[model samples]
Target: MITAENLTKRYGKTLAVDALSFSAPRGAITAFLGPNGAGKSTTMRMVMGLDRPSRGSALIDGKRVQDLPAVPRTVGAMLEMGNHQPRMSARAYLGWQAHSARLPRTRVSEVLELTGLASAARRQVGSFSLGMRQRLGIASALLGDPENLILDEPINGLDPQGVLWVRSLLTHLAAQGRTIFISSHLLAEVEAVADRIVVIGRGRLITECSMAELRERAGTRATIVSTPDAKKLVRVLREDGAQVESELSAQEVVRVFDRSASQVGEMAAEHSLRLHGLLQEKVTLEQAFMELTAGAVEFRDGGQEPSATAVPSAMSDGDPQ
Candidate 1:
């Protein structure tokens, strides 16, 4: 397991990382998420022993990374895919890493095939696209077949097919009981693959929990009701101690926050009102993230605030897609 115990970092007078504490457990994929300048890179650097922490420690299996024996065999990290020798071929790069780690030379080819880089093994590092470079970096990390993998934005630049491939690869790795901790800004992709998420903002930890737990804690679920007597239903729902809002397009619809579809349906039925539709709208990961990090945002444009927008409502034309 990877553990951060009150990990803090300071660059001159600026506190880059606050006293953050969390764990990336084994046999699961944990996604690290944060806004710009939220100190995600700094934390990852500390974990890899690339940067000295101002206070506290980052430990793997109860030992600091610098103190670990055979670091490559214990943990593999890929922070920057672009930081590589330009003239080296993909195969040569992995071969060098394998040699340095005292790993079998054959392992280089194994990782190449594992990362789908066997076809382009002979390609020059300088000539490969960003996506291919990412694959090469991953191949190097996996060359040692370490039990833990720490990757920062492993899908920075990739087409749809490449994205899917990376997702499948990470999921498969986690299924093999390897500890996979990744940092990404792609929330949609993260939601699809990550079993747990750690979110930080402004150098402070905001939340860390499973995706399902985070959604449940978001505390934002609404019942969307479509009926001909929208105004009457809205009044009735409010009178029943439910907060409601209305939206009128071609058809009449109302949103009852903190209420379930079943409750709304029963209430409408008791009132003898005909209902066209009823949907229980739950908070998505994107919505939960936006709400959680709203106050922690260190930088913002001169645009509307996050709180200004309502939970995306279902259109009266049809249920939410």
Candidate 2:
């Protein structure tokens, strides 16, 4: 397991990470999430021992990363993808890395194939596309055959097929009891694979919980009803303590918040209302993420503050830091 206990980092007077703490457990994929400039990279650097933490500690299996007997074999990290030599072939790069880490030369070929870069292994790094470079980076990370992996934006320059392949690979790795911790801006993909999430804002821990718990606590489930008597149904739902919004378009759809489809249907029946259709709208992961980090956004489009009501009480990890 990878654990951070009150991890903090500072650059002169600027505080990059502040009293942050979270865990990425084995056999599960944990997503590290935050808005831009929220200190996610800094925190990850501290965890990997690339940067010294000003306070607290980051541990891997109860020991510091630097203290590991074989650091590369214990934790393989891909913090960035552009650090490789441009003039070197992909195969040559992996071979050099494996040699430095005292790994078998055959392991280099294995990872090249595993990351789907075997066909491009002979190509120079400068001649490869962004997607190919990404694959090469992943191959380098897997070259050590580490038990834990930490990746930052592993899908930054991939096409749809590449993205799907990465999703499958991460899932397969986690199923083998390897700890996978990744930071990415793609909430849709994160939602699809993450078993839990650790969200931070302004370098502070906002919340950390299972995906199921996040949905149960902060997800908004709304009921959508299509009815000819939209006005009447809106009034009925409002009187029943449900927040209702009616769209008086050709379809005459009404959205009722904090109510289930069955509840809305029973209410409509009680009011003798004619309904064309009723369905429940499950809140997307993006919606929950926005609400949880509304107040923590470092930048705004129009220099406007976020709505106070945008953050729900249940979503708050604790009293604001």
Candidate 3:
């Protein structure tokens, strides 16, 4: 297991990471999510021992990555792909790293095939497209086939096919009992692939929860009703302990927020109310995220709007595709 105990990182006066703590256990995909400049990259860098933390520390098993018996063979990571050499082929680069790590040299070819880079193995990494470079970087991370995979935005530059391939590969690795820790801005993508999520904002841990637990805890299953007698319906629903809001352009058509569609249906039937429309509406990931991170936001409570015509309501984390 990879665990962090009060992990904190400071750069001069700015604390890039606060006292955050979480774990990535074997046999699970733990998603790390945050906004831009939210200290996600900094935390990952600290975990990989690329930068020493000003306070606190991260460890794999019982030892820090810096104190591990073997460095690259214990943890494999793909942070950014811009550090590739200009003249080296993907195969050559990966093979060289694998050999240096004393891993089976044949594992290089395996990683190339696994990342779907076999066709581009002989191409110079510098001449490759952003998507190809991303794949090659992932290939290098998997060269040693380490027990842990810490990928930051692993799908940053990829075609639909490549994205699917990476998703499948990660899911498969997690099923094999390898710890898969990933950081991403795409909530819906992680919803499909990850078993647990560790959400942070402004350099602090917001919530660490399983997908099902988050859905149950944060997401509200609401019943949306549109009726001609909006005011009357709202009055009736409100009498039944359901939260009603304003959503009418004309006379009396109201939107009610109830815990369940069945509850609304039962109340409507009891009151003998004629409903024009009633349906269940799920609170999406972005909506839940907005609620989850409301307190963590810096300028939201302040009187500054990013724009005059910007969206008044928050955005939900869904339907990124």
Q: Provide the overall lDDT of each model, using Cα atoms, as 2-decimal numbers.
A: 0.83, 0.86, 0.77
* TM-score between model 2 and native: 0.89
TM-score of 1: 0.88
Sort by TM-score, top down from the best: 2, 1, 3
lDDT of residue 123 for candidate 2:
88
TM-score of 3: 0.82
Q: After superposition, how far is residue 182 of candidate 3 from its true place, in Å?
A: 0.6
Q: After superposing candidate 3 on the true structure, give the runs of residues whose Cα lies further than 4 Å from its correct spot.
A: 225-241, 245-254, 268-279, 295-321
40-141: candidate 1 lDDT, tens digit per residue:
888888999988889999998788989988888889999865687789988898888888889999998899898888998888899999888888888888
lDDT (tens digit, per residue) of candidate 2 on 1-321: 899999988776667788999999999999999876678877887888888999999998788999999988899998866799999999999999999999999998899899888888888999999988888888888888899999998888999999999999999999999999998889999999899999998778999999999988965677899999999999988887889888999999999888989899998899899999998888778998898887687657998764442222111121111
- Candidate 2 has an lDDT of 0.86
Candidates in order, TM-scores: namely: 0.88, 0.89, 0.82
Worst-scoring 10-residue span by lDDT in model 1:
312-321
lDDT of 3: 0.77
Clashing pairs in 3: 230-252, 286-316, 286-317, 287-316
Ranking by lDDT: 2, 1, 3
